[model samples]
Target: MKVEQNADLPKTTHCNKSRRNLTEEEKEARRIRRVLANRESARQTIRRRQ
Candidate 1:
């Protein structure tokens, strides 16, 4: 008898298709802006403490 390993398991169709959907550039831009804002806030805090 042959044994099937975990790696041979079948994947769901949804899993294969879902990854095709990606975030838009506008959404990415917004995310970057939020990160920069947080960094700037942290810098201000350190400067104020000094």
Candidate 2:
């Protein structure tokens, strides 16, 4: 009986880039949404403790 070993492999490189820009309004909206999400999570934690 005989066994063969395989331990050689090649790595690949990726080069991805973004191609879209956000306007000022869009940026503000994203910031507000994130703040609201965090606030909601904190409220949930306080409710659990009560």
Candidate 3:
């Protein structure tokens, strides 16, 4: 039996523009979002466990 290889697969993408650093406000917003997501996840877990 013979196996075929994918030659057109890309190893990495070439991003022309580098990512910029997030400011303090953006960081705070991200933190708030994370907290809310975690809270909802915990609620769902508790409901499932009950």
Q: Write the per-residue lDDT of candidate 1 for residues 1-50, one digit (tens) a residue.
A: 22223322334455665565445884676566666666666777898999
Residue 18 lDDT in candidate 2: 61
Error of 2 at 4 (Å): 52
Q: Who is ahead in TM-score, 1 or 2? A: 2
Off by over 4 Å in 3: 1-19
List model 2 lDDT by residue over 1-50, tens digit each.
Answer: 11112111111124244635657896776666666666666777898999
Q: How many clashes show up per model? A: 0, 0, 0
lDDT of candidate 2 at residue 8, scale 0 to 100: 19
TM-score-superior candidate, 2 or 3: 3
The global C-alpha lDDT for each of the candidates, from Candidate 1 onward, is: 0.55, 0.52, 0.57
TM-score of each: 0.50, 0.56, 0.61
Ordering by TM-score: 3, 2, 1
Clashing pairs in 2: none
Ranked by lDDT, the better of candidates 2 and 3 is: 3
RMSD of each: 17.0, 18.3, 14.3
In terms of lDDT, which candidate is stronger, 1 or 3?
A: 3
